[model samples]
Target: MKKMMITALSVVMAFSLAACGTKSAPDSAAPQTGGATPAPDKKEVTLKVGATAAPHAEILNSIKAKLKEQGVNLEVKEFTDYVQPNVQVFEKQLDANFFQHTPYLEQFNKDKSMNLVTVTGVHIEPFGGYSQKIKKIDELKDGATVAIPSDPSNGGRALALLEKNNLIKLKEGVGVKGTVRDVLENKKNLKFKELEAAMLPRTLGEVDLALINTNYALEAKLVPTKDALFIESNDSPYVNILVSRPDNKDSEAMQKLAKALTSEDVKKFIDEKYKGAVVPAFK
Candidate 1:
């Protein structure tokens, strides 16, 4: 019995010595490039995702499973507001973000001189017109008050959408970014008021027609396919993007995420899910 007890103690001490100060395989939940090695069969990505709570996060949810198949462990982080996500990305707290379009992203970079770039276009959310007071565009009376996003980019978006619906006409080469001042013609004789993008949807009842951004409009229970009087074109270059630091624009995990979000499966998902409210921009 004394010999057996001594042998058991020897085995336990050997195991303890092996574990002390000995690092196991690298965490499969994060990247370890200094002294640690990647796990043999798994790739770890402490990828941070910054996005809106609904569709952006909802879209990410659909791709999480597909991304995992490529051995990338993604952490999809949700942001309720728009500005913080970009700041988080610039601060190196996030791996990639998906919430804004090319024009907005360009504006963000130009405004802050941050080095953010899009990996790929994921979805195009249409800028739309909606109203509870008026049933449809044709129902809008002459001299009716219309509210639109006051910001440059989205105000231009609203104008383009208005132009597309033949409610207004723009000067040649005015482009989709044209504003209320750029309206070479306004046939409907409607009055225009510029309000912040986030406020337009909530002010719907006060105006005959209100141009609400897709995301906010959706939050207000407005469905582009049914509720919107008009929606932007499907290929709206303003399509929201999946973005990362310029340095990791082509990283393996980033590539996997970009591809997964734009994959055929996702395309079908958006088509069937948003019902034309959200258009998959990638062909």
Candidate 2:
């Protein structure tokens, strides 16, 4: 009987040591569940936002700590392509996205049934022509090929910009989703080679000129102010925008984030960092 008791106690002691040695939940994660529903568990909210690498992601990174103070956590995921962010937000994978603009968003919703909506206007990255072949706008040849983004809205933006600088001409009121097909007159007869927005900078060396998006240009280390043959007006309606799901349009999380984006600190960051390539649209 004494031998039996000693064996049982030894087994218990071994189990206790095994339990102590094995990994378990950290003490900080311990539940404080009492009778009263645990005070809502402090509501640890997380927001996942998608954006382009440079200015959009960089801009969000700058304000992430500020957001953490308000009981919010931010995850800024970067994408090289434009289409996925809107699709991700539509599929409810992302909380929000900050890229593209009002017109593009409208066209995307109409075409893809994504139902995406803009929450706030961010900065406009002026579309412009960059070229290793031509030092000035006047050097564009009659049939020289220039690369442009393939997406309809941005293509129109690039076309409009080229026209603005006397590089081409278009029908009146082509708006943001305009393309080369909308051009009523091409005074220069510039042959446009449409490529992905991310690929335009790579085409700069091969083509006489390329109409590059600001974000893509920024990605390729091409600054619009210093490298472009010509640029679009920053005041153009085709500015980049911050977007969210249509259902979440009025959510408090979005409101807090939008307010934070338009704060003076963000405005100052845009003005100082991007120079004139990016401009605060909040004011």
Candidate 3:
């Protein structure tokens, strides 16, 4: 009876030791729910904008840090041609674009049947005429080839500039709306070559004179203030603008970008960097 009792006691002790030897699950293995819940981090908004290489991208790059501080990350995509920027914005691939003026935007909207509105006016890249073949405007010979932007608005702008310089005369009151067909008087009997705005800079040697936008001229290393045979006045009506769809035009991020673009810092940067090549449209 004593041996049986001892055997029972031994059995109970062995069971206890076996249980202890089998390690239990760790506390870390359980899902924690009792402690305070951690707050989620605020997400940063990304604002993608398309721009021309020179002043547009350069200007946008200047204010990146300021936009970032406001929880908006600015991504500037550089474009060589004018059409894709507007196309990308209209297709919702980009948040906005900053290369064209109000007139061009209006014409683009009308032509494409797309409604991209201007957020704010940033600066005026005065349209100018450049030539590698001539040193002066008067040096352009009769029947000289003059290359201009193919688009209606800019073609008109270039024609108007030519008219303003007395190289040609458009129909009365045609003004900036005139096309090559409106040239009523051609004192030089100049031939008109309409090319893409981006290509004009490269055609300097090919054409007697290529009317180039300031942005392209700058990209090609041509200094507008010094190199342009003739340039539009600073008060010209063409003001390059920030453009977006009506839906997102007034968003917080877009507004912040617009504000930063027209800020005093940007004004100073334009003044010091572009000299008289680019003029700030904002007061």
Candidate 4:
């Protein structure tokens, strides 16, 4: 009896020891607490932009590094003519373009039945009148032929500049919508020849005076501040802008581009590199 009781007690003690030796599984039912939430995934973006060669592309290239830092890859396609850039953007071949102003964009949208919008104003290339035959506006001979851009948007700008400098008089409130027919007075009997904007620079010797866009003037190695007879006022409404489709106007990539283009570095770059040829429109 005594041996039986001792064996039973030993078995009970052995089971208790084994139970203590065995480790308990973690409390799987308990909620985890005090840990950081994972960060959101950032989407990588590549923005393909179309721009003019001299100032527009140059300016876009200047911000390539900055955009990269913001996780955007910039692909700048150089365009010599203005039409293709907008067409490409409208067709979704490019993300955005930086070669035109608000007035031109407005006319283009109307003419093409598309919906493109401005992201931001980048710079102003003043419209000016250039001449090799005449030294001043007053020296223009009677019946002297003056060449202007044939496109309605730019032709209107040329006429506005001519009117501003007293070279001619446009009818009241005719502003940017003015045409050659809108001329109220032609005091110098200036014969008007409307030509393509790009051809105006080459026709400098042929015409008494050529009203030229500052971009083409620069391309022809003509400095508006020095060579132009008169230039658009600093307050001119024709400030060039960064443009995109209306739907993409608020996209992350477009917003980043607009921010980078109007950044202090870009402003400084324009002021220094182009001198006064391209004026910053941000301020």
lDDT of 1 by residue, 103-193 (tens): 8888778888888988998888988888888776788888889898876777887888888788888888877678888888777788999
Give one digit per residue, the lDDT tens place, for model 4 in 1-283: 9999999999999998887666442444345565655678687799999987878898999999989989899999997787899999999999999989999999999998989999999899988889998797889889999999998999999998888888789889989899999999998898999987878899988989999988888888888889999888778888999999988999998999999999999999999987787899996
- Among these predictions, the greatest TM-score belongs to 3
- Of candidates 3 and 1, the better by TM-score: 3
Per-candidate TM-scores read 0.79, 0.83, 0.87, 0.84
lDDT of 2 at 269: 96
Q: Could you tell me which 10 consecutive residues in candidate 3 have the lowest summed lDDT?
A: 21-30
Residue-level lDDT tens digits of model 3 in 30-140: 567678566787688999999998999999999999889889999999999999999999999999999999889999999999999999999998889899888999888
Task: Give the true-structure RMSD of model 4.
Answer: 7.2
- Quote the RMSD, in angstroms, for model 3: 4.5
Stretches of model 2 off by over 4 angstroms after superposition: 1-41
Task: Summing lDDT over every window of 10 consecutive residues in candidate 1, give the lowest-scoring window.
Answer: 21-30
Instruction: Please list all clashing residue pairs in model 2, or write none if there are none.
Output: 156-178
lDDT of 2 by residue, 120-149 (tens): 887888778888987878877789998888
Specify the highest-lDDT model's number: 3
